[model samples]
Target: MTKKNVHTVPSKGGSGWDNKVGGEVVSHHHKKETAVEKGRSIARANEAEHVIHDKGGKIQQSNSYGNDPNPPKDQR
Candidate 1:
């Protein structure tokens, strides 16, 4: 399967998240929390990776729903 990533990133000119992939915006929202939830759902449905970014556009957290090449040290 083709691997895809869903991201919750700070919007360009507003307070929210820009769901993106490969630097392309796929969706937008007005609330980070909502966006994060949506991103998680999307990632789960697609069996992809969900990445959340902070207001500074820095990666905050990531969760993999599909096969991860390098999984975490702990499964718990």
Candidate 2:
């Protein structure tokens, strides 16, 4: 089954950050750290990926909670 990924992105109007699942906003936080924490929890629970975006809406990083199809070779 395809897991729905969670994303922490800059909110509209640029006031805060938002935790989104499957393109739907689940929660909002004034700080990016808080939003990332929330998003990580959701991603862990769902066994999905957590995608973090920069202020400019560009993808900054991502973490996989579920089984990855292509894991990095450097993983130990």
Candidate 3:
């Protein structure tokens, strides 16, 4: 989905202390990670697909779609 209407879902991996602090009953939107970090996470996810392709386990790398269209910083 485009950034304008990006969908966010709470993670199932809530912590042990969330309830004690009266944290939101559900987790907040997962802040998107930086490109390098996203790539790493994507790689691990793709690895799962490789397991199904038993003949060869290869995960194509993820491309960095890069920053937001209207980033806060100006071109230097």
Candidate with best lDDT: 2
Worst 10-residue lDDT window, candidate 3 = 48-57
Q: Rate the local accuracy (lDDT) of all candidates.
A: 0.85, 0.92, 0.26
Name the lDDT value of residue 25 in candidate 2.
93
What's model 1's TM-score? 0.83
User: How well does candidate 2 match the true structure in TM-score terms?
Assistant: 0.91
lDDT of 3 at 47: 34
Worst 10 residues of 2 by lDDT: 1-10
Q: By TM-score, how accurate is candidate 3?
A: 0.20
Candidate 3 on 3-74: residue-level lDDT in tens? 121112223463111110122321232342332243234334333110111112232232223443444567
Residue 16, candidate 3: Cα error in Å is 36
* Model 1, global lDDT: 0.85
lDDT score, residue 8, model 1? Answer: 92
Superior candidate under lDDT, 1 versus 3: 1
Q: Which residue ranges in model 3 land beyond 4 Å of their true spot? A: 1-33, 48-76
